[model samples]
Target chain A: MDDILLMLPGPTTVHPRVLNAMSQAVVNHRSKRYGEILTETNELMSKMFQTENQSYLITGSGTAVMEAGISNVLNAGEKVLNVVGGKFGERFKKIADAHGIKTQELAVEWGTAVTPEQIKEALDADESIKAVSVVHNETSTGVAAPIKEIGKVMKNYDALYIVDTVSSLCGDEVDVDKYNIDVCVTGSQKCIAAPPGMAAITYSDDAWAACENVDSHTFYLDMKAYRKSGNKDPAETPYTPSVSLTYAMNEALKMIDEEGLDKRVARHHKAANATVAAAKALGLELFADEKVSSATVTALKIPEGLTDSDFRGTIRDEFGVELAGGQDHLKGNVFRIGHMGNISYKELFQTFAAMGIYLERNGIVEDGAAGVSSLVKSYL
Target chain B: MDDILLMLPGPTTVHPRVLNAMSQAVVNHRSKRYGEILTETNELMSKMFQTENQSYLITGSGTAVMEAGISNVLNAGEKVLNVVGGKFGERFKKIADAHGIKTQELAVEWGTAVTPEQIKEALDADESIKAVSVVHNETSTGVAAPIKEIGKVMKNYDALYIVDTVSSLCGDEVDVDKYNIDVCVTGSQKCIAAPPGMAAITYSDDAWAACENVDSHTFYLDMKAYRKSGNKDPAETPYTPSVSLTYAMNEALKMIDEEGLDKRVARHHKAANATVAAAKALGLELFADEKVSSATVTALKIPEGLTDSDFRGTIRDEFGVELAGGQDHLKGNVFRIGHMGNISYKELFQTFAAMGIYLERNGIVEDGAAGVSSLVKSYL
Candidate 1:
């Protein structure tokens, strides 16, 4: 069998160089050598986030950030508005609610995107909301929510505007400072092309103030403590940072900067376009509206007689391609094709070709030509 | 300057093989290939831990396990008794206290051990204490506490016995399954001779049950959740496991098991004795009582007119021997020589010779003869 391609939203196919970085034995997190690595890495991460405010390098998955965001900022009965559109969006509410924070949720349809208008409506309706949180790119629905639009609306409100850029940060243009995004958090595995472990977070003074005012219940992710420790020296993390991932991300971020964030995002856009085009040529419906569809992932409605898991399993087991099945409520109906991180058009073509072959072998399609042709035509 | 030897408690000098293992580029975490690695790793880690309890790998440092240990088992107001002697002991208390667990601390002097009698007194004094915690080898003062004695004493009581074996496990023998120890935890960077990001922990059914009953505040390090997630399938984790550290640990554990656990501990003991022998031959004073001194890190009092940091730093800067200076209340007063993890006899002698060179350079010794001679005689 051929090597499998990961087309999932996260824990995405890592660049070989990134994995090579993880393989090195762990280093002393406190050594001057590690300190230099941490110091320089923080500087580079600041450049990537386009923020002057200090940041933290956390050692957990993207969802860990949602927990940290709430545990750091919100106290019990403190009001926070969570935008609910996809699975990740609901995660914001779940985490906040679990923390006993009073939460107001702006709900959207499963396949639809949450708009700035929706965010405005939610905020205007709730004067008690201390923070407005939303996903920049909802991986589950394959929709890039209007972060800039929401940011514009949120600028008028006193509430801090926090965004989950986990699937979007390096996959697209997220000028964190320009957006006035108080808290912008992302994971390592997606657009950075590193493996899962670390979550990179940049926060504004207002966000820090909120986190600080709320006394710590959060351990392992006490952002304020991390800020205090890293402040002494950016090389010093409050807890044991994942040194290997820090090393891998150091390299991955460099690769991103060398390629230029613009070109990287453009590549992601091209791959998503090719994926959508190939799906269209195969006569499959897109789960998300094109206007709001994510440039990093494409959620497709499972074709007739095909279940989401079955389609993904065949892609993995037979064609050596891996696609993400829709999660939670949308399960069994849609499968997603991820195009972010170190991925390229060339890889997308291979993924689509694999998909086509799997469909043909499973008697789900008459021939493999249509899907592969469309992906090639997308490049042409 | 020569390539410095790291004689600090941890992160000890990493093995080149382990470093090379970590340099392998990222692999998709959810891939069958990586899953195979986890499956093998899970089995190997279980063996290293001397447990049938499945391995639940976290991406953070050893303190991560302390936080996870408490958060998994302690609810708000649940009581804990900590046998505090050194840094790691205090660390365990801080972690528990941070979680709002009611704690009774049995504070031993800085350079002394925590006896089972004192632990029982603390336990007898506080019936509300659900867990009695101790650091097996206090990294701070080179004191090896009596976990076995404490475990034996605690057998008469109902509270779970949780031991922090971070600096001692693998390098020192820990009969985790033998001592009615409910929770036994260690770090990879210590005696395990692996990288720093992972923590290895074992739990008895009693401790697992306690974790289940507690209303834990954490999402990331909740041991019950980790156990449940791993129990879903033999090869699963609740969150993104550190694949790179997992790989390095897999290799490190194989090395330890091959060397034989008893022999590995014996090797460490011999090396430690050699370091102490060399220190004594040079007319240096050992900080801890000889009886309870750790077989990993040996703390020594700085000679008159020679401050600890200056002495250790000179060794690191000139001779490439990285000995550790004291922390907290003991700062600048003592230095430690670590015989933990991937270090050796030649390495030990080299460090001793450096110390002698420094002493001679400082006019304390006539020449480097004492350092070289003492270490050589010990080896002979």
Candidate 2:
């Protein structure tokens, strides 16, 4: 089988340099050299998240961070407002429920962003709420919520603000301190351009304060223990971390550093804009509003007469360009084009060229060249 | 500096094939190809663990498996017998304590094996004990417990037998069904010869019965969810796993299959015997009794007049050989040599040669060549 380009919400296309980094010989997790690597990675994570808060390189999926964010910060029976806008957003309530934390869902329609007004209303109605969990970018619907605005509203309350930037951290601006996010968590496979396995999480003083009197009942995922160990000289994870993934993450972070976060975010914006513009030119509607469209993944409504399988399967099996189908309730109704991580403008252009030919042959669009023209115009 | 030979208990030197495996491009965890890989890996793990029982490839450290094993099988307030022999053995009790589980410590001295009589006594003393947690190979002290004997005793009781074969699974003989172990857990970086980050665990029917009534408050580490997902035609993990690590683990397991389990165990035994013979010839005392010495890692008493730092540092800095130092109260009192994983007998002899030279230069021993001679004799 030939190599297929990854165009999913996560487990993005890793750079060859980053993938090769995983081939480095295994080092003792407690060795001095490992400590140096970990400390450097931690610093890079803080810079990437735009926060001076204490950070951790935890070995688990992004969901581990979500669970830790809820398990550590809120005590049992304490109310936490979970902002539900999409599938990933709804996960906050599920995690909270699992932890026995009382939760009230601040529901927002799928493909719509959660507003500051909604957050304010939720917090105002519940003075005893200990935390507010929000997803910075809803991957399920490709909508980036107005976290800065929500953060401003959350400042008036004593609740700890937790944000899931799993699909948006480096691809979009997630200024943790500016947003007053007490905890910001992300995974390696998304915008970090690393493989799936570990998550990078940051915690503010407020977040720690909330965990002070809490009984997290977890030993492996205990945030406090990780914090205690990570704060030591040279920094370290509490247990043996996935060193191969950490090495790959270090290389990925280095690439991000070379590209510059601002330029990287702009690159993502350009890719997303080009994808959205081309889809529209091809007579496909955007699933998310243009104002709230995620810079990481662009969701497009499936055109009539084209089955989800026909669309994605042709893109993958025929052209070797793998595009992600919609998730959850939106499955078969929409398709997603992931523009995050190491995907280049050339690759993005090629992806559209292939999509153009497919659309024209399938009679979904009259002119394949029109989509190419729009993509070129957007790039310019 | 130069490439150093890893001689630690875990994160041992990975095979070149396994390292190359890590360089495979990232794939979507939910994709069909990924599902195939997962299913194949699951079958391999079941074989590797010497069980036809259900297995899960959890994305975390060996400690994660330990926590998951306890959290999933037994509930809060359930009494468990923790066989405390070394640091890893004691962790069973620590994890149980963190989860609010009632624990009775069947304490055994470090560097000593726990007897079946001790286990029988503990179980006989407590009729309500729900589980018995034991470490098959205590990496901290290089002691392989009498699990087969302990298994015989547990057969007479209703308590579930949970064995941690983290450092022993592939290096030594551990027939799960033969031992009647209900829950067996191991890690990737140990005898499996893969990188750290994942734990391979198996559960017997008896263990699943215990979990049926248990409400493990974890969403990420829940074993039941993994079991359900993995039982699908295309096996899947409950959450996004470390795909890179899984790839490496696949290659590592393949190597084990090619080498044959019986031959692999013999190789480990040969490597261990050579190291022990060489160390004893150099006037060093074995940390664990020879009767129960582990085939994976060999712990040795640090000769007097040589600080642990001076001992291990010289081996690492001068000879490019990294040996693990003792942990906890045994810190600075003992050193460990890991012979498990992809390390060859040639490297073992080289390591002994290097250690002998370091011993001579540090005035810890008179003759360096005598150690090499002993190693050669043992190999013959």
Candidate 3:
């Protein structure tokens, strides 16, 4: 089978260099050479997080680090304010609940961003709340929360701020220190343009302080263990890491360095803008609020009378383009176009060209070229 | 640096086919195509485990699944029998302690295997023990536990049998059902010859029954979630998996299928026999008892005058052969040669040749060719 162009929320199209990096021989994780690579990678990751806090690389997916962020700092029965807006947002509460941590959920409408006022109100009502957890970009809804604003409100309280930027981070604006984030997590397969199976977390001094008070129940995801191993002579993870994935991550991060984070983020923004414009040109309504739509992904409502299978299946099988359908409650109602990582204008053009042809052939739109024209205009 | 031949216990030299498989484009984890791949991979994994019990793939290292096996089936304060002989063996106890589980440690000397009699005595003494955790292969000490014997003893007890074959499965004899293993865990980077960052766990009906009674504290390593997602229409992981690694694992498993498990185990045994014979020919003392030595890794004591740096460093820098040093208290005292995965007589010849040259150059052995001659003879 020919390679399908990945336009999903994550597991983005990897660069050839990154894929080639993974093809190298596996290295001993405890060796000095691997240690040097790990140290360099962590340094680059710290820079990407825009924080002085130490960053930890985990050998699991984004959810693993997310669980690490919560379970390490907060013990069972401790109150935490979880902002629930989309699938990813609800995950924080699920993780908290799984650990037996008491969650004070601040529910927000799907496809809408959580407001700082709501967070403040919840925190005000619960003086015992130890943390406020939010997702920077909700891939399921294509909505980016106002984390910076929420961080400001959190600064006034004793609650630590935990943020999940699994789908944003390098693809959008994220200043960890400036946003007062105590614990921030990101995944490798998203904006990093690396393969999945690895994730990273940045922990502030406050988070570490909280960790000292809480008796962590986790062994593998323990942040203190990571910090201890990471502080060794050459640095290391507590356990064996995915060695090949680390190589891929190092190469991908180097690519990000070469491209410059500012330029990379701008490219994601441009692609998102092009996708949104093209959807509008096709007379399609977006699933997310325009003001809060994500810079890394765009969610468009499926055209009236068109099934998700009709839209995504044709784009994938017939056009050789893989687009993500909506998740959870939004399934069949919305379709997402991921424009993060190494995606470029060329890929964007092809995606719209396929969508336009499909819509026009299906009689959903009069002009098959309308979406492509809007995409081209945005690039210009 | 040129490619260093990996002869470590894990992260061994991967076949070009497996490495090339990882270079494929990333796919959406929730898509049908990915689900089919996942389902096929799990089926292959179950066969490798030699069990009818369902196998679940996790996006973390072997340690993560080890934690899953313990945490999911046993609750806090539940008594468990932890068999500790080496670094990896002690890890099970640590994980149990981290989760607030009451552990009755059956301590065995390092460089030695735990006898079935010892386990039977411990379980006889403690009727409240909910589980027995043991490592099949102690990589740190190059000791392979008598799990089949232990299983016979465990059959008379109510304790769930948890075995960690992180470095043993595929490279040695492992019959999960025959051994009565309730929960069996193995790593991808070890015998499977895949990249790190993924692990598999097989759960029996008794293990699932135990899980139902316990309130699991973990979120990411929650076995129930994996079981539910894996039982889906097309089968899926609870969270996003390392897509490229999954591809690599699938290809590696296919290679295993082609080679056949019986031949693969025989090959490992041959390589191990050759390594042990060569070590003896070089006048090196085996670290672990010869009777209980691992078929995948052979540990040998360093010569009287040669420093670990002088031995391993020269072998690595001058000869480009990478071997593993001892862990914990055995550091610098022992060196291990991994003969697992897709290792062949060619790689083994190069490794022994390097060792022979280094030993003779250091005046540690009278005849430089003695070790290499033994290796060649064994292969012949």
Best by the lDDT measure: 3
Ranking by lDDT: 3, 2, 1
What is candidate 1's fraction of native contacts? Answer: 0.51
Worst 10 residues of 1 chain A by lDDT: A19-28
lDDT of each: 0.80, 0.89, 0.91
Q: Which prediction has more favorable TM-score, 1 or 2? A: 2
- Ten contiguous residues minimizing lDDT sum, candidate 2 chain A: A1-10
Candidate 3 lDDT (Cα, whole model)? 0.91
Instruction: List where candidate 3 sits over 4 angstroms from the true fold.
Output: none
- TM agreement with the true structure for every prediction: 0.95, 0.98, 0.98
Candidate 2 per-residue lDDT over residues B204-249, each given as its tens digit: 9989999898987688888888899899877889889999888988
lDDT digits (tens) for residues A54-108 of candidate 1: 7678877887776787667778799988888898888888777766788888888
Clashing residue pairs found in predicted model 3: none
Best by DockQ: 3
lDDT of 2 at A201: 89
The residue pairs found clashing in candidate 2 are none
Tens-place lDDT per residue, model 3, B1-380, is: 33899999998888999989988878888888889889999999999999998898998889999999999999999999999999988999999998889998889999989999999888888899999999999999999999999999989998999999999999999999999999999999999999888999999999999999988879998999999999997899998899888898999999999999989999999999999998899899999999999999999999899899878998999899999998888999999999999998999889988988888888889998998899889989
Interface RMSD of 2: 1.5
Error of 3 at B15 (Å): 1.0
